[model samples]
Target: MIPLAMLAQFRALHHHLLRLIDGLDDAEYRRQYHPDLSPAGWHLGHCLWVENHWLRAVVLGDDRTTRHDARYYQPQYSPKPERGARLPPRDAQLATVAAGFEANILLLADQDQRLDPTHPLMTDHYLPLFLLQHHSQHLETLRMVMTQRALSRHRHAFHPQARLRATPVAHETVSLEAGDYPIGGAAPKAFDNELAAGNARLEDDTIALRPVSNAEYLGFIESGGYDNPALWDALGRAWLDDHPVEAPDHWRRDGRGWWYGIGLEGPHELEPRAAVHGINLHEARAFARWAGAHLPHEFSWETLARQGRLSLAGQAWEWCDNAFFPYAGFKPFPYLEYSTPWFDGTHYTLRGASRYTPAHTRRPSFRNFHTADKRHIFAGLRLAF
Candidate 1:
């Protein structure tokens, strides 16, 4: 039987995720914030599907849901733009969510002795913890989607006055005497992507003490950094030509000046000291180029992460130059779909935890990745020279 403590934690995570959607109406709930991101309703249903897949089906050998709604929720079937059309009615989706949780609770109560010891959840009795982390990740995505929609449609949703934010300190480039450093760590709860610990021989390079702030990024924007083709790589320039983006995705403008967009918290006048996020890798690379700096490699950033040089506790993730490639000796975990599909050299690696990152999964070895052009996630930039 799952311990009461573990069951309580799972229930708490599920409740917290549902709470994110508590106040929204039907229209708001179904809105797709971006072309790439799933709707809130889909997120809710997907979480239930995932929990049922792992905790109930895989762990307890219950496969009842496979025939009815599982295919609808599969990643292949529920691509972002199509999710809203593909999903069930809002009431039905919510009911599925409730039923999924109830099934999970029953599964936890089964106390099945035939469970596989090698199962991911059973490996260290961290099944519930893993589910909690998964829920946390999706919840953050939902928040981002909601905040972006709020900024675009309802500016009034945000508080008028500025909320307190992280100010950028006087950042200096500090040099690391690099050598063969062991990369990744043995965090018991670490994801499959962080496994197969490897070593890298890094060159001695100077790295930023913190991420680039709005003030620093403003200089680039005001100087026509977006228009200059020389500052960007060919692919980036091509992307710019097609998209013609003027600023970071999170930055909004008024008759006065550009302001930063904080989802749910409302838009605040740009704070010079606050770290600039919601920027894509191309923008980050362009900024680095304009400043005669370079984005840090994943290994170099991990050095800082290892040393605890920066305040990573609640900071947004920093973009790295490394693409999401597997380590030298790599093997897929129980779920091959998690990390295998993304290693196509299109998505770049993002290092460090975000404000929404769960404390339990936060580690120097943790690696997050996304397509280089995507900027909706909690992502920012840091420099290395």
Candidate 2:
């Protein structure tokens, strides 16, 4: 039988998703704020679709028609730019989502059908946990979408007292006597990419105790880091040429000094002590180079994290130098598309959890990957010497 704790967690996540889009109007819910992100309504519908696709169809062998429309919900069937327009009316979409959630909960409670000991996904209640984590991931994306929407619409609802004061940037570093360290482990909750436990060899290296702060990154910006071609690689230079970004995303300036945009709350002063976010791999690498340092290898970062030497819990996602690849004995799980499709060399790996990242997804071995030029993912950098 599915554990009550798992079911409770699922319900809580569902409620959290609803609350994220609680005050949004129909237009806001259906509008796609970022080019890469789908509409809020679409995300809701897509989650429901995934539930039906995995649990009902794949697990239970129930071939009934899905409650959500496949054309708009299935990512392959609909492109990101077109998903906003294809979404159903807001009320209709929410109604369908609500019904689907209820049905899903009931289905999970149906031990006779869904809790078969012989089923792979059912053993140890993996399917429910997977679905919960999947929902949690989308919740983070919705927060990003909300931030983009607030910036696009110039909705500044920030209070004066809410501005964060600058804090001193620590220069503390930790030295690791590296050797062959355990890399990924065999955990039921771990995604397929973080599976097939293995060991990675590393030379002795020194790593930052914490992620680079906003103040340090600001110093890079002031020192003409963006203008210097020496700080960037070929791919980085090409991205810079096209984007022409002088600073991180969500940053705006007026008569007052530099201020960064927070999701829905609008603009606030940059917190110097906080880990610098809104930077892509290229920008992170440039900052590291400007400091005469380099981004840490994923192996080093993971080892440090495992030893509890890294202060990365609930901090910004730190980019690693290594490109995202499957572990040595990697194999795809329930579906091939999740991790297999993104293993191309273009995607770089990020470690740690962002402030917006959910608690359940913040484990050390959990890997977050993105392309070099994509900066919107609350990502930052740490240097290794």
Candidate 3:
């Protein structure tokens, strides 16, 4: 049965998402802020599409709503760069999402108590939870895209005096004894990629209690970390060929100090103690090399997290040392597009969540994977070994 509280939460989340795009103009809503991001309109429609399809179409066999253009909604059919062109007008997209939400709410009234034992929604008991999580993931993406748009629209215009500053704090590394530690797939709501929870035999190692900070990364910048070929791997160097090797996304220099921006917050002076926000795996790896440390493996991260030794939750996603791949006896979920398509060894696994990450979806087992060169996400690194 769908609990009343759960239903209320669902309504609240929908409202929150609506407010996120409440003031976006037509151009801003439809703008593809980056090659990696879809337009805001596309995400709004896609979120509704999944809820409508899974709840009404798949579960109730009641796909009365007209289907969206497959070319715009399907990831494989539409690449990221071309999605803006495929998206409908901003107002039409908003109306479509609103309609889907209303339909989904009505469907929720027929609680699972009436569902047959073998029904798809019943068999996959977490479908509602999954839908909520799916929306949360896309909401994070939308938030990032929106943040990028904000930064681009108001670069260096923010006043330094009006901006707030974060006080510097010292961080410590904690030691864990050698043992077999379990990682991923432990949580009931874990995604398919985190399934087949496996044990990792870890040697005695030390890991940072918190994520690496902007001040720490600045040392890497000053030391010619980008120019030093020894610190960067071949792929990292290759990635730098086309992109600026120095400075992370959202960061800029003004004479002697640095400033960074995110979302609608405008820009602020670089916070020495705050976790660095926008470094990709390659960049994280290079920074680790410069510090004479290494990125923690997923297991090590989980071990620290399980022990409650880890800090800085819901701040920055931490990069793992391992490449993204399926575990032994892995099985794809009903949604085939989630993980199986990305197991081509091109993406590295990242663990944990950022400040903008939704509270309900923050799970230690949640494995986030992206290409090595992608840096727009709120990703940072923690030192291991």
Score every model by TM-score: 0.90, 0.94, 0.92
lDDT of 2 at 385: 77
Give each model's whole-structure lDDT: 0.76, 0.82, 0.77
Cα lDDT of candidate 3 equals: 0.77
Q: Which stretches of candidate 2 lie over 4 Å from their true place?
A: 111-114, 155-170
lDDT, candidate 2, 1-385, per-residue tens: 7778877887888888877776788999989888878889888988988899888777777747464475667787888888877777888877778878888887887755644656888777778878887998899999888888878877444443444344443568998895889989556788899989888888999998989887787788878999999999999999999999988887665445545656556667677677888999999989888888899998899898999998754578999999999988898987898899889999889998898888778888989999888878888998887
**Candidate 2, pairs of clashing residues:** none
Give every collision pair in model 1.
158-266, 168-273
Whose TM-score is greatest here? 2
Worst 10 residues of 1 by lDDT: 160-169
lDDT of 1 by residue, 49-166 (tens): 8887886677768877654768777877656777777666666667668777876766665565556667766776667667777787887788787777766674543332553333
Q: Which has the greatest lDDT?
A: 2
Clashes of each: 2, 0, 0
Query: Which window of 10 residues has the lowest lDDT sum in candidate 2?
Result: 160-169
TM-score for model 1? Answer: 0.90
